[model samples]
Target: MNVTLFSKPDCKQCDFTKRGFDKHGIDYVTVDVTADDSGRQKCIDLGYSSMPVVLVESGQEIVHWSGFRMDEIKALAYLEGAPQ
Candidate 1:
């Protein structure tokens, strides 16, 4: 299972999103779009303009969302059959 979070520095929403993931004990890889070129390109490729883009990928299950969405976060956090 892989969880990726697209974020940037000095972003309040990004901080909120990260804190939420931490609080929920959801391990994830954070991609700083403002720091890395590849990360910025990925955000563009994914058609995302928000600060925190959460992507939960595991085999056939590939779900993603932009900004701070607690509902989505909780869903991914409690997803069954997902490999930790």
Candidate 2:
């Protein structure tokens, strides 16, 4: 499963969220909105007018959290292993 995190540099919440993902050993791609125009557009395209948005592989969004909740993220990640 792919996890995409859209964030900007110097964002404390973004740093905190990344740390949670790292602690969980989850592999995710980070998109720095300030560094890439396209990345910023992508975040806007998702209807998120804020930073630190997380997109799960199944097209579900777990966003707008001040900090990453491990249990919620893990539950979403575990959905990848759910039987169809």
Candidate topping lDDT: 1
Q: List model 2 lDDT by residue over 26-84, tens digit each.
A: 67899898898997887778777777878766446444332455665666546644321
Top-TM-score candidate index: 1
Global Cα RMSD, each model? 2.9, 4.6
Model 2 spans > 4 angstroms off: 59-71, 80-84
Residue pairs whose backbone atoms clash in candidate 1: none
What lDDT does each candidate get?
0.82, 0.71
* TM-score, model 2 to reference: 0.73
Error of 1 at 5 (Å): 0.6
**Clashing residue pairs for model 2:** none
lDDT of candidate 1?
A: 0.82
How close is every model to the real structure, measured as TM-score? 0.87, 0.73
lDDT of 1 at 73: 71
